[model samples]
Structures are given as C-alpha cells and as structure tokens.
Target: MKKAEVVLIPIPAMGHIVALVEVAKLLVERDDRLSTTIFIMHPVLDPSTTKYTESLAASTLPDRMRVVNLPNLESNTEDTKDRNWLNSMIESQKPRVEEYVSKMRTQSQLSPDSPQLAGFIFDTFATGMKDVANGFGVPWYVFSASGAAFICSMFYLQALHDGEGVNLTEFKNSDALLEVPGLANPLPAKLLPSMVFREDLLAIFLEHARTLKETRSILVNTFLEFESYAVHSLSNGKNPPVYPVGPMVKHVADGRDLRSDESNKYRDIMEWLDDQPPSSVMFLCFGSWGSFCGKQVKEIACALEHCGHRFLWSLRKPSSQKGKIESPSDYLNFQEILPEGFLDRTLEIGKVIGWAPQVDILAHPAVGGFASHCGWNSILESVRFGVPVATWPLYAEQQFNAFQMVIDLGLAVEIKMDYWRDFLGDNEIIVSSDDIVKAIKHVMEEDSEVRKKVKEMSRISEKSLKDGGSSFSSLGRLIEDMIDNIS
Candidate 1:
C-alpha cells in the first residue's frame, strides 16, 4: 500500500485552526493510505493564539496525523495597523516553510517507501504559501474556513472591481443592491465586507481571490442543502471545483483542557441551564475574536434586562493595547462595564460570564435562541442545534453572513446587517435595547418561520453527514481526488 501525505497550513487563530484541524482529522480517518501534517504559523501578534497552539499541539490526535509548529518570528509592531499586515506576516514565513518542505522532499527522495508529499492545503489567509507548493510541483488547494457565500462574494466583488470598473470605496455608504452569484437575493452594497471599501486592504483580498482560481479545489465548510444556490453559483466550471463538506463545527465533548476557573464557570452555567425549561434560554455569544466597548456592553445589559428572557451571555473585554490582534479577553470584573445593578436586576433571569462553553450550551435543551456575531462556525453550530439566531455581526464577512441568513435564506432574524466594529475605535452605531428586544422575541417565538426553518435545517445538517448525503459524498470525492492524483 502506497502512502501519501497532504500538508495543511492554517492561520494560527483558534477559530481558523479548529475547523482546519477537524477537516484534517476527517481526511486521514477516511483513508488508511493517507496521512496529514498541519503546519502552524504563529501570528505572533496575540498571546491567545500561542496558548491555543500549545494546547492543540498537546492534544491526542488520530493515527498518521501530526501537528508541526513553525519557529516564531519576532513581532513587528508597525504592520498591525498597516494594510499589508496580514500579507506581510504570511509572506515572512514562506521561506521557512519552503526550507521545511525541501528537507521533507529530500528525505522522501532518499527513502524508497516513505509517504510522498502529494499536495498542499492552505487556509484562506495562508494562500501566500501557494508558491512553495508550486516549487515542489504539487497541486495546492484552499480550505475555506468560511462558507461558500463569502467565497463567492469575494470572486464576484473582484470581477465587479476589475471588469466593471466600479469604484468600490463608494460602497461604504451606497444604497445600491448587488446581484452577487452565491446569494439568492440582491446584496445591499453597504453590507459587503467592510474591507472592500478600503483600497489598500481591498488589494490584498482581491489578490487572494485571483490566486484561488488556480487551486485544485476549494473545500468550503458548508453543506449543499444549506447553500444550494450559492454552491451552484460557484460550480460554474470557470474556477476550481468546489466541494461542500461542512457544518464542520466542534462538538461539546471536543474541548481543550480548560483552566480551573473556566471549568468552574462552565459547570455553573450548565447547572443553571439544567434547571431552566426546555428551549427557554437565549444564548448571546460572539466568536472567539468578537468583543465590544463599554458603551455597547452596557446597552446589551440593558437589553437583556428588558427582554426578560432566561439568557447566558459571554462577555469579553475588548483589547485596548497596541500592536496586538484586537481579540477580546475575559473581564476580571463585569461591573466595570455593565450598568449599575444591571446584573442584580437580571440575576434571576440571566447569567453573564467571561467565557462560554458555546457548543455545550447550545446543545442543551434549555437553549432556544442565539444572538451571535454571525461567524460561520457559530452560525453552523446554531443551525445544527435547531436554535434560531438573531444576527449581530461584528467583523470580517459576518455582516454578509447575516445578510445571507436573513435575506437570502430566511433562516435567522437580524439586529443589523452592516455593523462592522472598526477596531480603530470609530464605531458610532449602537444597536438599541428595543431592537435587540424585538429580535430576541422573534428568535424565541415557537411558531416563527425562522425558528421552523432552522429546526428543519438542523435535521438536514445531520443527514448531510450520513451516507448518500451531500457533505458525505463531497468529502468522499475530495479524498478520491487526492488518492487518484497520488497513484
């Protein structure tokens, strides 16, 4: 039996690495003749990233699956604010990756029976490593940690900018609607990714979209039933083949070793939820990097207090320090941010904590609604668990994700469709308590159409992983393609 190895390069963020690692595990587990090596490129801008990598490196993985941590480079404080920050950071690691791959190639050459390095699988942010994959005469693929809708949006925006000669900067406040391919409805121009309005940052992403056209395939973390129209749009035969193998969300049991404080907090949350009625609790959690200012936090506290729903809220302190990735951290004291007596007034009906066991909480019968940042993983998890969502997007492609769910698919209620938290402290829009209360009411309503739709989709999401389902067949195809190329 000939063995072949596929190399994975994932951005070091926990959210990005978690999904990629799950896919890698799925790949090697599905094929005995295959193995996977994941290369971790530390962002060097956030300590949370380092902690996550260390945890993942220490975890027990499946057979023939290995985690490799690259040597960390010194942090460059200047690029954190530069338009080219992400690109420059990724580019600096290329030489080291190249050297490592070259050594592996030499060792394979020297040995007669070792697994041949067959291909490169890159995270969306790590596409800069494509040149190194090319240097070895191997095909490179993209593992889209986001959904098909976002990838489709990227390509369409690229075409709109290059072919149609539109000034994208005008889109920041434009009232025009765009007929993007993946979305079923016309997209509001203002709801497009916040980066599209910035020329410098737009240049970086447009280049990524161009490079993606050259890949062997793009494995999107979405199922066909969820985004059939969007998936169909991407399968137009002009670009690389796309495979929808997802809802690749982590399970409640699949967690890292939590600190003692985290463990205690999680236990308390579950205990509180276990006492609540089925489908009675509303969960408010942003993604790993999601956080807000004191003003917004107070607004949410007021909203939660007014809504009168049994709620579990994960609140993190927004990063104020310079040169660090603007991720949120656990607040040492909640009173510093929340309104006075807000916690006491809502104490019987709500629980606010620093970090949440999101999956576990969602899986619990008490959870009926999610007020999420619309991160793809969080969206998938909410859908998978039959919980309706009230979208409160923060950054990246989240605003668009919110748009797709509310307008295109009618699967979730919406708070705001264009709220991008500008980390430079320019965020002026504050979603009022009244609007949040309305969305919460809509999501928790038992007979609401969105709730019905999410429940049905949750059932479909389960079947998509079974035999004869879309995601299962898609993953089988991806594995066969790799094996056939190797043979």
Candidate 2:
C-alpha cells in the first residue's frame, strides 16, 4: 500500500494559513506514512501576503511536509468584512484548486509507489474542498481553525435562522439566545457569528454545514480536555467522526522555546523585556487582521497609562480606516493614529511596536498577561506558554471563543466579550480606560484563577501530544483511517 499524501487547503488569511501549516506539520511529524503538501491560495492585495507564503516555503519543515503556492485570485471588495466575502473568494478558486489537484493526481499515478492523495483536508473557509474531493472520488475532511463550539454553531446556524424563524437582526437587540445543538450554553446573538445578519452569509455557512456532514470526519484544533461537551456534541449521531487533536500550538510551538521565532529585528524588544521582572509585563496584540479604530487605539493608550504596568502593544492601523492605509507600514506611525501626548503618557510603562514577535514575547518569563482578540490560534499559543489572557473579541466567531476560554476553559478573563458592540454605529460604549486597566490588572494578579488554570492547561497541552495522549492517538487514528480508505 502507498503512503497517504493529504492535500491541506487553508483560506488565504494569515490566521487560517498559519493553523493549517501547523496541522500539516503535525501530520508529518506523527505518522511516518503521511505526506502533506499544503496549498496556500492568497490574494496578492499586498506584497507582504506573497512574502509570507515565500517565508513559509522557506521555513524548516518536516521532510514529509511541503508548502506550495496557488496562483493569486482576484480580490473582492464588496462585503469585504463580511464572512460571505471570504466564502465567495474560496468558491471562486474551486476550478483552479480542482484543476491543480487533478493534475497532481494524474502525475503521481505514473509512479507506482509514490504517495497518492488519499484524502483532502480544508480549513473552515476552504470547505469548498468537499466538492473537489467529491468530483474526483476522494475522501475529504473539514479542519476547523476554531474550537468545536464555533464549528458546531456554524453547523446549526441556518436551521435556527430559517426553520426556527429566529430573526437575527432583531435578536441583536433582543434578549434571545441561540439554542444551538451541541453547545452547553445559550449563545447571545451578540456572541454568535456575524453571518446571521445577511442571508447570503447564512447560506454559505449552511452549505458548509451540509458539506461537513458528508465528509469522513471533522477536525478541530482544540483538545478534548478543553472542550469535552462541544466535542461530544459534534461526534454524536451521523455527524461523522470528530477528532479533538488540538491546543495545536503545543505541536507547533517548538517546545515552548522563545528561539522558535528567528526574526532578528525583534531582538531589541526581547532584550528590553529581559530587564523586567518575571511575569510582570503585560502584552497586547490583536491578530494580523485585528486593528482598532482611532478612537479605540487612543482608549487603549489611555488604558496603558492608567494600568501603570510594563506592557508591549503590537499596534496596527485602524481597521476602520481602511482606505487611508496606503502601505503595509502605515500602522507603525503611532503619532498619526494616537492622540497628542498619548505616547508620552504611556512611554514609561509600555512599549508600542508596530508588530511584536508574538510567540517569543509570550514565551518569555517576564511577560505574564496577554490582551488578545480571542483568535483561536492566539488563545492556543497563550495557553501553550502559560500566559493568562484578557479576552477582547473583535469580530466573527471570536466572541464565542472568548466565552469558551473565559467561561468554559477558565484560562482567560474577559476584557469585553461584546467588544463589537460599537461596531454597528461606532458609539455603543468605549470600553473605558478604567475598564481596560481593571481587566489587565485582573489577568496579571498573583495567584489569579486565570493564571493557575492557564499553567495547568500548559501542562495538559504538553502531555496531550506525547505517546498515548488523546491528540497523539487521535492523530494516529486519522492517518490509519486515511490509509485504510486508500487500500
């Protein structure tokens, strides 16, 4: 029998791409017979996007895993912030993705013993792989970059919206909560994904929900210990096999060593951190797509000034000011986005860089707390390094992730679960500087529950990847199943 060569497709965003790369690396690491080729399909809106792909190709990867670039697709503008826009981008790439994979299959057929594509795995947005796999008679799986809870909610959103007559727009202001299947709690409309508002986005999610049910299995980047109820909900009935092989940063963090980030430019930041006391500094960073409006950035600056603790903020250009940003480095101009004297006020207590070496900063002993956008990958990284978090969700299903971390996992405290409240009109309520300061103080407190819980989770994250651990054995089962399908 030939080895199983799985093609993993990730949606173009930085977070989605990074998660798939890590999972692809893990597949190659755990199974000798598994070979992976990841196709990165990015829209060349920025030179930096292409540069990122090239960097991934250049990274030190396992011998069995390789990264390849898919040709850039046409960028879409309308509904750009809407989840539907991303879904449409992925759908538009289907023809090319299929053509390329079919060509690879045909070429590999010439070599009798060469590893053949026994399976297809697409991350959440790339669930378009279901049709590609079906068209060519190959098994496929959906690898959600988020927790099982969000995946489950997405799977059931349309039913609640259409069949249950839940008016999503009305629910935004109402007291109704989504009684989604598989989730233990009633999710407030504010906590639900933004897809509920528009019929087109709901349709996209519903299609993926249907596609997922037809797959061989579903994979989530969360551990069983962390999401037992949600995982159980997904595995029940004819929902396909649900594998909880995650807290993925453990497999990808290079054993929690700060040297994993080799970028030389951030050495000064690390050196500055070395002077701080252990677990004394706070770190604030949203994801690559995460940026605050000018109003929010100023509020953050005020928060840092009032907190009076050593902090490192990875500030990006205001997402609200999209058209004004002409270059990738525009966010580096703090003076432009920040208020006069704001930098001076916080200079003594905080360091604001355009971007910080996140993994390295979190791994450092001196850094204690993280104020995060609740991107699933960042949450896993924070837990991996035992850094407690202040959950500050900005958009999409991030609010759900915040709930999972703060209420379900006890690993993080909430800065503002409904951080997007102001997103509609830009005047819901500025999470006051006082509120931000309190949240950070709570996260960094000595003997805090968040700290203790995160430390324990760090140990569990390490253990879950070793032999006989749930993730380890689950990965083994996944490989064996893929090979079995081939034979």
Top model by lDDT, which number? 1
Per candidate, the number of residue pairs that clash is: 0, 0
The TM-score leader among the candidates is 1
> Where's the lowest-lDDT run of ten residues in candidate 2?
321-330
- Compute each candidate's TM-score over C-alphas: 0.95, 0.90
Q: What is candidate 1's CA lDDT for residue 77?
A: 42
Off by over 4 Å in 2: 44-48, 74-88, 250-264, 319-332, 339-348, 421-428
Error of 2 at 335 (Å): 3.1
lDDT of 2 by residue, 1-487 (tens): 5677899998776667777888898888877888898988756334455676887777677788888786655565434455466666767777887888778788779987778888899886677657788887889888988888887787677566657776555555456776766666676766777665566676676777777777788888988777788888878785789888887663324643343447654767877788889999999988765666667778888888777888988887644543332223436567888779877877766788876567778888999999998988898899889999999997778888898788766789989997773343344556778889999999999998789989998888888888988888888888889888778
Ten-residue region with minimum lDDT total, candidate 1? 253-262
Q: Give the TM-score (vs. native) of candidate 2.
A: 0.90
Say what the RMSD of model 1 is. Answer: 2.1
